[model samples]
Target: MTRADAPPRPENAAAWPRLAVVALGLLCLTEAAKLVAFHQAGPMPRASDAGAYWLLGAQVARGDVWMAERPVAYRTPGYPWFLGAVQAVCGHWAWCTAIAVQYAAVWVTTVLTGWWTWRVSARPWLAVLAVLVCVLSAARASHASLLLTETWFTLGLTVCGFLLSRPGALTQSRSTVAIAAAWCLTWLTRPIGAALLPAWLAIWWRDSGVGSGGTRWRAWPPLVLTGVVLAVGLGPWVVRNAVLFGRPSLTVFLGRELWVTTFGPGRPTAGGLPSTPEAEEIIRRASPDGEFTDWGGNWSVSNRLTASGLSDAEADALMARVARQGIAADPLRAGLRFVVRGIDYWRATYLRSLTDYDDLAGTASDVRDGQREWGNRACHRFRRAWLDAAPERNLLVVELSAALALMGLAGLWLAPSRRETALLVTALIAGIALSTAALEYPSYRYRMVLEPALIVCGVSGWPVLIDVIRRGSRTL
Candidate 1:
C-alpha cells in the first residue's frame, strides 16, 4: 500500500492514554501532602508497616542489617537501600521524593502496559483500557505513600515482561542486556521475581524464538548474559545469607508466613486469612496436630522461636518443615486451600489502606489490624483489613479485577494468537500469582505485578468469547 493509497490514520491516535497518564500523575501528586505527616512517625512500633521499613532503611544506611541478633530475612535490601538514599537527599520529607520517583515509574509502567497490549492484540481500545486500569489501581496509589516494594517490583516485572514479549528480543545483544537488567532489579527487590526467569526462557524457546535452526543458536548468548547478570546482582545477597544464616538464599521470611497461612485455623476468605471458630474446628478435623499451630496464633510462632534459641535461618527451616508436615498430614485440605488462594489471587481487588495514606499510624490501629468492630457497614479498605469506609471504590475495583481475570482467561485460551504470546503472558502471570498464594495469605497487594497481563489478556479474549457464544446459539 503506497502512502497515498493507505487508509487515513486516526487523529490524535494516542490521546486517551496520554490523558489517562496525566490524570494518574495528578492523583499521585496529592500524596505529597502526607510527606510531612510521615516524617512525624517516631522510630518505634506502630500499626503502619512504614515504621519497620523506616527503621530498617536506617539500619542499612548504618551498615547494620542485624537487629536483636536476627538477620533481616523478611525484607530485602533494595527498598531499604533506596530509602536510605532518598533520606540522604531529603532529610525530613524523604517519602515525598521517593513516591515521586515511584509514581513516575508507575506512569511509565502504565504506558508500557498499553503498548504491550497493542503489540499483542492490535486493538487500540484494549490498549487504552489497559493503561487506564493500571492508572486507577488503588494498590499502586496506596503503596505510593508508604515505603514498600510493590511499586518497584511492579515496574520491574512489567518492564521485564514487556521486553520478553518484544518481537525477536532474544536475538539482539542490547535487548538481552536490558532484559537481564530488568530481571535483576526485580529479583533483587523481591526474590519471587526469580520465578519468572524459567517462564520467560520457556516463552522464548517456544514462542519468541526465530524459526530457523541457524538463528536458534543465537539464544545461547542471551542465556549466558542472563546468568551473568543474576550472578553479579544477586551474588552479594546470597553470600550474606550463606555467612549469617547458613542459607544460600535471598530471604527467610517465607518460613513464618507459610507456617501461619498453611497451618493456622483461618478460613479461606477472599481478602485474607481470618481467624474463626468454624475454621478452628475444620483444622481440628483435618489433623488434630494442626491445633498446635493455632495455640497462640502468630504470637505462638515467635514465642516458640525465642524459646527454641534457633538462629533465624534455623527457625525458618524448622517452620518450613512444619509447613510441609501440615501439607502431608492433610493434602486434600491443603490443596483445596491452595485453589481458593489462587481464586483470591485473581479476584482480589486493590486495598487502599486509607488510614495509612493519612499517616495516622498511631491512631488507625483498628483499621490497620482488622481486629476492631466498626459500624455495621465496615468496608475493608486495605490489604487483609476488614474495615476502612471505602467500600464503594473497593467494590468497583473488585468488579474490574474479576472482569479482567475472566477476560484474560478466555483470551489466553481462545483468542487469536501471535505465536501464542498471549498464552505465554497468561502462564507467566498465573505462575506468579499462584506462587505467591502458596507463600502468603490472599492479599490484593501482590496483584500489582499482575494487573497488566490481566488487562491485556482479558481485553483480547472477551470479544472472541462473545462471538463464540453467539455463533453457538445460532447453530442451536
Candidate 2:
C-alpha cells in the first residue's frame, strides 16, 4: 500500500521481529567465535568422550552393534546415533558435517531462548540481550562447539520448554501425540532426559480436563499416544537386550557399569576410596547376588557408572556386597558412608577421577597409533594447566555466574507468586538432588539444563534494575 493510503502500524508491531533478527545475527557471531576460539576442543576426558562418540558412530556406520564397543561403552548411543546420521548424510566429511550441524543447533537453541523469553516477558530487547550474554560466555561457548551431547540435549530441552509453554497447545489428540513423541525423542536424545517424563506428566495433569465427564475419552488419547511413543522409542533397545542378551531393558550400558563401579579395584590413593567406588561398593555389598545394578530403582546404579570402567564396576559390586554384609554386620558405617558420599557428589568437583585411566594400558600401543595419542598428550597438558590455573578460572566464572544467579534470585523473589517462581527452581533442584543422590558428582555441564531457566530469571530482573536507575536519575 502507498504511504498515503496505508494506516500507520503500531510501534510494537515490528519490534519483536526486529529483535529476533538481531538475535539471529548475534547467535551467528557467537557460534562463529566459538568455532574459531576453541576449535580443537580442549584436552582429554573431553577429548576421550569425543573420540568415543566418533568411534561409536564409526562402529554403527560399519554395521556393528553401536552399543558393544570399548572405552566407548561409557556412554549411550543416543547422541552418537545422531552424529552417525549426520556422518551418513555427509559421507567422508562426517566430522565437518557434525560440527556444522552442532553449530547450527547451538544458534537455533539460542534463538529459541530469545524467542521464548520475548514471548513470556514480551521484552524483545531483553530477549536478545540474554542471547548475546549466553553466546559470549566462554563456558557456554566451549560446550557448544564440542562433540559432546550436552549442547544437543540442552537444545532439545530448550525446545521442549518452548513447546510446553503454549497453554492448551497440546490438547488435541494429534497435538498431544506430538508432545508425547517429542518427549520420547528427548529421552532418546539423553537418558537423563527421561526426567522430563515427570515434568511433562505434571504439565499433562495440570492441563488435562481430568474431572470433566468426557475425561476418559480426552485423556485416553494422550495416554495412548504417550504409550505408543515411549514403546516405539524404547522398544527396540528393550527387544535388543531381550533377544540378544536375554534381558528386556533400555539400559544395557548401565548394567555392566554398575558391576564395574562397585566391586572393581582402583588406583591406590590417599583417600580411603573414591566417592564413586565407595558408593558403588555400598550398593554392591547391599545387593543379594553382588550385582550393583537395580533398574527398578530409577536406574540409580546405571546413572552412577555410565562413564565408569570395568574396574569401577567390579569395585562397585564388591563394595555393594561388602556394604550389604556390613550393613547386616554393622549398619551404622555403611549408612554414614552413603550420606557422606552423597554429599560429596553434591559438593565436590567431579573432575579428579574423570581420567583415572586404570585400564587403558592394554590399548596403549593401539592408542599411540590412533588419534588418542595426541588427545592423551593434550589431556595431560590440559590437566596440568587446568589444575594449575583452575583456581583463577574458577574464581572468575564463579563470580560472574554467581552475580547473574543473584540477579535471577532477586527476580524470582519479586515475582507475583512465590509458587510461580518455585516451579522452575524446584524442578531444577529436584533434578540436581536426584543426580547427586543417584550418581557421582559430575562436571559443570550436568547442571546445564538449568542454565536457560537461570538466564530467564536473570532477564526478568532487568526491569527492576532499570527502574532503580531511572529513579536515581530523576532524583539527580
Candidate 3:
C-alpha cells in the first residue's frame, strides 16, 4: 500500500532493474544448490532437530493440540505448527513440500533484504551486491536447505530489522502498526526475539515525543496494543505450562538446562567444587542431593520426571542451593566463565556445509565407510576430500566473504549519517553476539541470518574504501 504522504519517487527508479538482475542471479545460484540437496535427501525430515519439528507438524496435521510440555514448550509454536497447518491442506504430500516452502520463504526474505538495502542506501548497485554476498556466503547456504527452525526464525527477525531500520516507517501510523505487528510476530517466532525488547523500549521512549499533544499519553494505546497482540499469541503456552507442569514458567526448558549446564558431571559447581567423574561416581555411591543440581542432570531431568515431577518450589530450592554454593567459592571466576561462555556461544561456528553439520550423513556416506569411529581421523580425511571435490565451487565462498567484509567496513565509513552507521554497526555486532551466545552448533548457519545486513553494510562501504585508496595513491 502506498503511503498518502510518502515522499516523491527519486529519478533513479530506472536503475533498480540492474539491482534486481544481480539479486536474481545470486538467488538462482543459492536455490539451485538447495534444490540439488533436497532432491538427494528427499527434504531432510531426518535431520537432528527435524524429528521434534516434524512431529509437531504431524500432531497439528492430525488435529492433536499440544500445550506446554518440557523441551517442546521451549520452542515457540510458529514454525512447527505452521508446517502442520500446511500439512492439513496438503496431507502427506506436505512432508515433501516443507523444505520447498522454506526455500520459497527464504527467497522472499532475500529479495526483501535487497529491497531494504536499496531503500536505506538509495544505491541500487550496492543493494544488488549485498544480495549477492548474502546468497554466495557458505554459512548462509549451508543452513538454507535444512529442516530446522533457523530459517523461519531468521526470516521474522530480518523483517523486523528491515521495518525498524527506518524512522520514516514508524512516523506513518499505518506503517507503525504494521511494523509492530511484525515485531510481535517475530517474538512469537523465536525466544531470541526477547533480545529485541530493549530496542523496542528504546523506540517507544524516543517516539513518545511524536505522539498527540506531546504528552506521551497517545503512545500508550499502540504500546498496549502491541503487548496485547503478543500476549494473545504467546499467553496460551504460558497458561498451559502453569496448568500442566504446575510451573508458571515463561519457557519450558530453561530450568532443566540451567541445572544441567551449571552443575552436572564434569561441571564446576556453584561452590567452586570440581565435579569430576569421581564426584558422579560418589553421587551414585551416596545418597546425593536428589535435588536437580548434580550428576547427569540432563538425562536425569528428562528421564526421572514422572507424570508429575518436582514442583516449582522444589526446583527453585535446588537451584538456589547450587547457585549459593557456586557463588560463595568463586563468584568472580564463575561470572567470568559465564561471560566467556556467552561469548563463545555468540561466536560459535554455525556456517558450514550441510555435510559437516549432519552426523548421520557423514558417518554413513561411502566416503566414511572405512573411517575409524573411535578417533574419527578417517572421517576427517574423507570430509576434507569430499569438501575439496568441488574445488571451483569453493571460490564462491572466498569471494563472497572478502567482498562482504570489505563492503561492511566501507559502509561504516561512508554511511550518510551517524544514525545509519550506528544501525548497521549495532545490528552487526548484536546479531553476531546474540547468535553466538544462543548456539554452540558451529556452522555458518548462525551467520546466515545476518548475511543480508552484513552485505548491505559491506556494499555501502565499498565506495568509501576505493576513495581512500585512490587518495592514498595520489598522496604518494
Candidate 4:
C-alpha cells in the first residue's frame, strides 16, 4: 500500500526529542501534584485492607508469609509482599516511601499509555493527549496516597499494552517472554489479570504465522511458556491455600464478593453482612444477637463461623456454597444483576475520594459523611445540568464518563481496517469489565486500571473527529 493508503505512521525520529520533553514535563508536573495531594491528604492511617496489608507485611517481615492465625487466601500476595520488601529494607513501613513509589509507577504508566496509543493509532499528538488524560486524572493520581493495587496494576496493564502493540510482539520469543512475565506479575497483583489471557491468545493466533505456511506446533511453546510462568508465579500461594483448605483457590474473597453483589444491597450501600437471607441466617445463627455488623464483611462471616466451631476452610466452603446457591436459584435475576453491575462499574466516579479532605481523621469512617454529602451535591449538579435525570453519582465523574465513552466510540469508528488491534483492545476492556461485573459490584477503583486503554481509544479518534468537523465547516 502507498503511504497515503497505509495506516498513519508514528512521528518521525526528528520528533523524538519533543516527545521526550513533553513526557518529562508531564511526569514532573504529576509528581509535584502527587506530593501536594499526599501532604494535603496528610499521613493517611492504614485502614481496612490497607491495614490488613500493613499487618501482613509486618508478619512477612518476621519471616511468615501467612500472617493471619489461619491460612489467609482472601487477598493475593503481590501488594503485601511488595510492602513487606519495602519495610524489610526501610526497617519499618513508610507511607511516604510507598506513595512515592506508586507516584513513580503512575508516571511510568502515563508514558507507556502514550507510547501504546501512538503505536496503535499512529497519532503522536493523540498519544500526548492520552498521557495528559492519565496524568491529570484525579482518580489515577489519588491512588498514590492509598496503599492499593491500582498503581501497580495500572502500570502493569499499560506496559503490557505497550509491549504487545509492538510489531511481531506475539511471535517474537523475547517479547513473548516479556509479555508473559508482565502478565504473571499482573495476575499476582489482581486476579483480573487472567481476563487478558483471551486477548493474548487472539493476538497470537492472528499474528503468530501459524496458519499461513508455518506449522501449528510452533505456536505451542510461547503459549506453554506463558502458562508455566503464570503457574510458577502463583504456585506457592496456591499451594499454601491447598494445604490449608485441602483445595487450591485463587482467592477466598471471590465467594464473598459474589454473595455481596448478587444478593446484597450492592456497592455504596452498606447493610448487614452477607446480604442474602440464607447467608444472613447462617451468620445470625453463629452470632448471639442474630445479626452481624456490616464492618469487615469477610472477616465478620469468617470469624463468626469459626467462633461457632467451624474451621476456616469450612467457613469459606460454606460461604461459597451459599453464593453459588443464590446464583443457581435465580439465574435470570443474576444475569440482570450483572448488567446493572456493569453499568454501575463504568458510571462510577472517583469524586468521593478526590474531594475527600479527611486525611487527618482518626478513623477512616470519620470523614465518610462529608464525602457522601459532597457526592450527593455532585449528583445534584449533574442532574440539573447535563443529565436530564441523574443517579446519585458525582457530576465530574458523570461528565468524564460521558466524554470518554463518546471519544472511545469515535476512536473505534476511525480505527484502521485491520481487526487485530481493535479486537485486542475490545477484548481486554470487555474481559475485565464483564468478568468483574459477573462476579462482583464494579467499584470505580476496580475499573480504574482500564483507564489507560480508554484514554488511548478516546484519543485515537480525536483527529478523525476534528477532520470531519473541519470538512463540514468548509462545506457550510
Candidate 5:
C-alpha cells in the first residue's frame, strides 16, 4: 500500500497509553511464567555462565574491576558490573533483584520493538502483534530469568534499530551519536555487536543520499564520527588490556574459541583440518582424553593450557595460531561450514532442562523437587505440560519462527523498490549470521539478540501475505 493508503499514524499522546497498557500486560504474563519456571527449576542459580558472571560481579563489588589475577578481557565487564551494583544494594537477594532487572530490560525491549514496527510499517495493530511475539518468545523470556548478556544486548539492539529506522536519523547529529553509543554498548555486552556496524552504515549511506548529488565527502565525516565515538567508548577497556597483557585485544578467549570450534573434538569433520601433528599433540596433552569442549564442559583444553603453563595471552595466541592453521588447511571446507553454520544458527534454541539457578537459601533443590511433585497434581497439568516441553523445539517456537521466516521473506519481496527498510533489516540478519558463523559453531541462544529484528521483519511481511491471499481468492 502507498503512504496515503496506510492507516493514520497515532500521535504520541494516544500511542503511549495504549503501548504502556500492552507492555504492562506482557510484563505480567512473562513474570507469571518466570515465577513458575524459577520455582520448577529450583532457587539455586544454575551455573553455566552464571557462576562466572557472579564471580566477576563479586570482584567488581570488591573494587577490583581489573580482576588482576584473572584478566577481565576473557569476558566483557558490562553485565557483571550491572550485577555487581545489584549485589551491592540487594545483598542476599541480589540474584532475585538481578532477575527483576533483566525482566525490566525485556519490557523496555518489547516497547521499543513495538515502536519500531509502528514507525517502519505504519501499522499500529501489526506493531502490537510484533510486541506480543517478542514478549511471548520462550527463548527470550527464559534468558531474562538467567544472569546472561542476552537481555541487555536485546534491549540495546532494539533501541538501536528504532533509532536507525527513524527518518533523518543519519543526518541528525544527536541521533547518529545515540545510535553509535547504543551499538558500542551492545558490543561491550557481546562481541556480535561489531558485525552490526555494516548494516548501520548501509542505512546511513542510503538515507544521507551521499552519492546522488552531494559531495561524497559528506559520507566520510559521519562514518569517522561513528568510529571515533566507538573508539572513545572502548578506549578504557582497550587501554587496560594493552597495559595488563601487553597486547591490544577485544577479548582473551576469541582465539581459544576459534581453535576449539575449528579443530577440537566435536568440531565438524565435514571440512577436515590439515594434519598438524605438533599442534594436535599439544591439544591432546592439554585436553582430558584428547577431547575439547567449551569452558563449561569437561576437559577444556583452553583452560588446561592456561593452568599448565601458558599465560592467558600466550594461550590465546596459541589457539589463534592453531585455528588459523586449521582454516588455512581447508579454506573451502571452512567457507562451506560457515554457510551451513549460518543456517543452523536460526534453528538453534535453549533447552529449559539446562537452566541453572543459584539458590541463596540452600533450599532451591528441595523446593524445586517439591514444586515438580506439586505440579503433577491434575489441576496443574496444563501449566506443567507447557513448562516441561523443550523450549527450542516447542511447537510455539518452531511454528512462530517458521511463520516469521517465511512471511518475512514474502514481505521483503513484496516491499517497494525504493523502500530500503526491509533491506536494511535483512542486512542486519545477514551480518549477524555471517559474523556468528565465522566465530563459532551455531547455537540457538546465540541468535537471541537478533530476535527483535527478526520479529519486526516477520510482522512486516504478514500484511503482504494476507493481501496476496485475498487477491488470489477474489480472482478464483
Candidate 6:
C-alpha cells in the first residue's frame, strides 16, 4: 500500500507582534528620512516657547536654574533639565541629540498607541492602522525635531495610559507609584498635563477594590497614598513659589496666558477693539516695539514690570486684572470666543497648518519639495503646493476628517471594552483643551499631546464601517 499522503506539517506563521515590530522599524526609518529633509531645508528658529526652553536649558547647563536673576517660576524644571543635559553633552551636536531622544519618545508613543488600540479594541488590524496614523501625522511626528514639551508630554500620557488602561493595573502597588511618578513628571514638563488628575482619580475610584473582596471604604488608603506621593513630589516647587512670590504658585504664567486671549491674537475673538492708549503704554513699556505673541517677548514685559518696582506676583496679577477687565467689558463676545476656541482645539489639523501657518509655509514647502524627490511625503496632502504660493486647504484632509468624525461617533457603542479608557482619555484631552481655551488663545502646537489618545479612539468604530462595506458588496 502506498503511504504517500503523510500528515501535513504545522505552519510557522509569524506572530503579529513580530510583524508589528518590523512595520514600526520601517515607519521610523521613513519618518527619519522626512526629518533629514526638513533639517536640510535651511534653519528653523527656536521661536516662541522653543526659544525660552532653549534659554532655560542653557541656564540649567550652567547649573543655574534662575532666569533673569529671579527664580524660574515661569516654567517648571522638567524640559529645561532634560534639554540642558542633552546640550551639556552633545554641545555642537546638541540639536541632533535632542531630536534623536525625542524621536525615541515618539517611537514609544506610537507603540503605545498601537498597543492600547489592540488591547482595548481587540483588533490587531485596527492597532496597526493606529500606529500608521500616529506616525503619518505631520504635526505629531515633526514635534520631535523641535525642542518643546510635546515629545515628553506625549510619552508621559502614553505611559500613563499603558499603566492605567489595563483591567487591574491600578491594583498593583508598583503600578500606582509608577503612574504617580509618570504623571507627576509629565505635569512638570507641561503644567497643563496635570489635567489628567481628575480622570486618574475617577479611574482609581472606579476600581479601587484593594483586593478580591475588600470594602469600598477600605480602598481609600491606596488613593490617599497616591495623592500624597504626588503632592509631596510637587511640595518643593510650591514652597519656593510661596517664599518668592508671597504665596504658593504652580508657575506665574497663567495671567499672561489669560492676557493673550483678551489682547493678543485673541483680541478679535474677545471684542476686536483697538488697544486703548493706557494699555498701549504698558505694552510699549513691556516690549518697546510691541511683540506680544512670542514666548520670550511676552515674558520680557513681565520681567520689566518686576524690575520697575513690582514683584513677580504683582506683574502676573496686573496681567490677570487686565485680562479680566477685557472679558468683563464684553462678556458675551468673550464667552463666544471661549467656546469657539475650545472647538478650534479639536478641529485643527497639523498637516494643513504645517504648510500654511505664519513663517512655516516657506520652509515647509522646501521640505515638501525635498520629500517629493524621494516619494516620502511628510503629509501626503502636499503634492504640488509651492513654497511661496497662496495658502490653501487640503481637501483630502477635510474629507477624511469629516468621515472619521462620523465613524468615531458610531464606534462609541460598538466598542464595549473601551468605555473606561475612552472616558479617561477624553477627560484628559478635553480638560486640557477647554481649560486653556478659557484662559488663552488657540494654537495647534499645543495639540501634540492629544494625538496618541485621539488615534486610539479614532480607530474604534471600524467594525461598523467594515460591516457597512461588506453589506454593500453583498448587495452589489
Residues 1-476, candidate 2: write the lDDT tens digits.
78989997888987877867776676757656654433343322324566667767766766665455442323555786886676556675565456556666766777777776666566777787778766655444345445678777777777766676566645777767676776677677667766665556555655676644445555666677779888987788666656544556554444333233232222121122234555545444445366554432323544444334334334334444433443444345434444554443333332423333322211322212122222234433433343344421354565466467556556544545322333544454455446433443234566655567667666756565465456742321
The TM-score between candidate 6 and the true structure equals 0.76
lDDT of 3 by residue, 1-476 (tens): 56967888879886677757765676657655543453333232243566566667667777766622333445666776787787777764564466567766677677777777776667777677667655544345344445577777677767776776666444456766776778666766666666666555555545666533467675676576667766776677677666765656545555444444354432233343344543343344333355444343543543333213544434443443443454445666555545655544323343234535345332332221122222134433433343345322454654555455545555455444534444544554465545444322223454456556555556665665676566742321
For each candidate, how many residue pairs have backbone atoms clashing (under 3 Å)?
Answer: 2, 30, 22, 0, 12, 0
Q: What Cα-based lDDT does every candidate model obtain?
A: 0.61, 0.54, 0.54, 0.66, 0.67, 0.64
Considering summed lDDT, which 10 consecutive residues are worst modelled in model 1?
371-380
Please give, for residues 1-476, the per-residue lDDT of candidate 5 as tens digits: 99999998866758775775676566547645644554344233435576678778878877776666566557876787887788777776676667767767776777777777777777777776876666455556556666678789888878877788777778777778888999889888887788887789778777668747767766766687788999998777878888988767666777866765575433345444356874675556586464553432222656687787877787777777767887888887667666667666766656555443333222343212111111223323333354456455554665468556656755656757415777677778778778777776666667777888887877877676676677842321
CA error at residue 464 for candidate 1, angstroms: 4.7
| Top lDDT model | 5
- What lDDT score goes with residue 200 in model 3? 58
Candidate 2: regions farther than 4 A off: 1-24, 27-33, 40-47, 65-75, 211-217, 253-392, 395-425, 461-476
Highest TM-score model number: 5
Of candidates 5 and 4, the better by TM-score: 5
Q: What lDDT does candidate 5 reach at residue 240? A: 84
Per-candidate alpha-carbon RMSD to the true structure: 8.1, 8.8, 8.7, 7.4, 6.0, 7.7
lDDT of 1 by residue, 268-291 (tens): 422222244433433443335544
The TM-score that candidate 3 achieves is 0.70
- What is the RMSD of candidate 5? 6.0
Compare candidates 1 and 4 on lDDT and give the better one.
4
TM-score of 2: 0.66
Cα-based lDDT at residue 121, candidate 4: 69
lDDT of 6 by residue, 441-473 (tens): 555556557667767767865564575566742
Off by more than 4 A, model 3 = 1-41, 45-48, 68-72, 210-215, 259-329, 342-347, 350-421, 424-447, 462-476
Worst 10 residues of 4 by lDDT: 366-375
Candidate 1 clash pair list:
407-458, 408-458
Write down the TM-score of every candidate: 0.74, 0.66, 0.70, 0.80, 0.81, 0.76
List where candidate 1 sits over 4 angstroms from the true fold.
1-48, 63-70, 207-216, 265-300, 349-355, 358-400, 412-419, 463-476
